[model samples]
Target: MSKQLIIDFVSEITPQLIESKDGKYKFRGIFQRADVKNGNGRIYPKKVLEKAVAKYQKLIQEGRALGMIEHPPDGKTRLDEAAIKVTSLTMNDKGEVIGEAEVLVGTPKGEILKNLIDNGVKFGISSRGSGTLIKRADGTVVVGEDYEFLAFDVVYDPSTPGAFPETIKESREDKPMELTLETLKKDYPELVEAIKKEAKEELRQEFEERVIEAIEQKVSKIREEVKEELLSDPEIAGAKVAVEGILDILKPFISEGIAGEHLEELKEEIKNLKESLKKKEDEIKHLKEELERKEIALYIEQKLSESPDGDKIREAGILKEAKSKEQVDKLIQEFEESIRKTINEDKEPKGKGVNESRQKLSLSEIHRKLGLPVIGG
Candidate 1:
């Protein structure tokens, strides 16, 4: 395979362009991620990025994780015109490379970067690299282990109305290629998540019809078991006797001429009633989802409307992307488990006879008690 030139853009929103007190500026946010498709439709396995980030750290330590104000003529970082000095670079547990870069003062190009930022011009962080490209028959491009990290350039993101949408912009073809994390994720791994996501939402939308049907089938089987249990258990003899008496009365009617015809009609009536109950269950599920959504929107508006940096957080659209939200949720769960283990070591709590002693409450119960969505919808 031919060597490929790769450019992966990081969202300007994920990182803050902090204005330092002494007339300096720094950019900090996620620089890269592993085991996911980058903006270029290239997959870098966790191991691949783990190794790359480890090696790249050495360059950062050397103050050589340099980059220019803009992409150079042929995918190179000319140190003499370097505009950014990467102060720190490290990967998080989720395989995202968090980086900090300071705008260098007393440099011609660096001054230009500072000016653009002051004027509210946004810059997307993009990496310049080269590697062997493997095209999966499925149209996914995998970045091989031979992949290398060059400088993280500051590419200007046009903020004007007519500017290209971030989704479409990453798909552009220059001699060098650029990838937006959103586009590739949407096109590939995320595509799977997107497809299932709606069904899952409808599932959370409450008692999905297919799901209800499955439960009804289970209930039908359980009804026979209930009858057997009731007949066998002496402690419930009253219930068993009542059931037997009803059966004895129905037995004559079930066998006779006019009464047998009436029994068939009664069975049909019961079936219709069951169908009506199913529709009611479906309706109840929908109501739960709707109530949860409205409560959430109202709470956010009333409590967090003026939240600090909420706009940036929302605009960076990190949590809003959903894939990242899934990552955060997993990490949060892992952390909760770790904390529970640490605090209640060797001593069981009273309620569940487990650590933390917290009441095990289903989200639905919690939502019923408080005005909250039952779960992620």
Candidate 2:
């Protein structure tokens, strides 16, 4: 079985214990384990194991944050949102809004620098150039190097608790420029529409291929119905033997892209499954035989208890093993006749005939003889 099958079986059986804190079935343990050799003698995927460990660590962190942890780790605590800054925004010549932020370090007024400081938080300082580059297949950078950039200022606030006593000021260097939407459509409309048309054609081709596939599936179904009808007619049976070959033809249509080695392995698996089913049936047959023997023993015991006399029991065919329904009926008729004969002799009848004294011997006894489990008796 595959590792996925093992996980599925575990989840289906005793889901509660294996469930994660997130209320979902988790394979954390499986992921954390080292690669093991499966029954097929192949090593398990090590990546699957590593993934489980990472998920387990994430769950631990979540549990710690939620206070569901029993013993939390003692370490330096880091706040995720402590470094954010508030500032003003201004649109530059390049259609980009520069967020001119300020953070107070020592006082409100300070020197503006481009370098980063250890304690001071710099927010909204850098102005990144905005443009898309179209590279060639030769790995060369695209043309249109006329891109423009913008600059912003960073200021600090010291009123908040634990705030650094330094004011951040960004450098005022290059001014911003813009490439407006109206300007692009007016001058570069041909280039833009050409790209759009190419994309539209590609989408149309993909949709056409899907339509063809759907029609082929409908055709395949119709062919299957006709083949079924031909196989059913005896007059066409001789000629229809070739129609069955249509299945072999269709097999390639369905399994066409499958690798040859994989197809061979699939056929071998079907053969193995047939062999396994045959073995199970053989085991059932053996169990049935043992059940028949135990049933006979039960019938004999019941007959003896009903009529204590030995001669009467022997004449009734009580000890005989009936292999068929006809044989059993004959045995019952003989027992009834003997009981009637005994009654005519004027002696008191022991109890009843073999049929009357019949008991339902549980199949459990047969299962015990065959070393298999039986349903409740």
* TM-scores for every predicted model: 0.41, 0.21
Runs of candidate 2 exceeding 4 Å displacement = 1-257, 308-312, 315-319, 323-330, 336-377
lDDT (C-alpha, whole model) for all candidates: 0.60, 0.36
Q: lDDT, candidate 2, residue 201? A: 82
Candidate 1 per-residue lDDT over residues 86-189, each given as its tens digit: 88878888988888888886798888887877787767887767665656656776676656677788877634443322221222233443445565464345
Q: Which stretches of model 1 miss by more than 4 angstroms?
A: 13-23, 158-377
Candidate 2 lDDT, 226-248, residue by residue in tens? 56754664434333344355447
Best by TM-score: 1
Model 2: residue 256 alpha-carbon error in angstroms: 1.8
RMSD of candidate 2 to true structure, Å:
33.4
Q: Each candidate's root-mean-square deviation in Å?
A: 19.3, 33.4
Model 2, global lDDT: 0.36
Identify the leading candidate in terms of lDDT: 1
List the lowest-lDDT window of 10 residues for candidate 2. 1-10
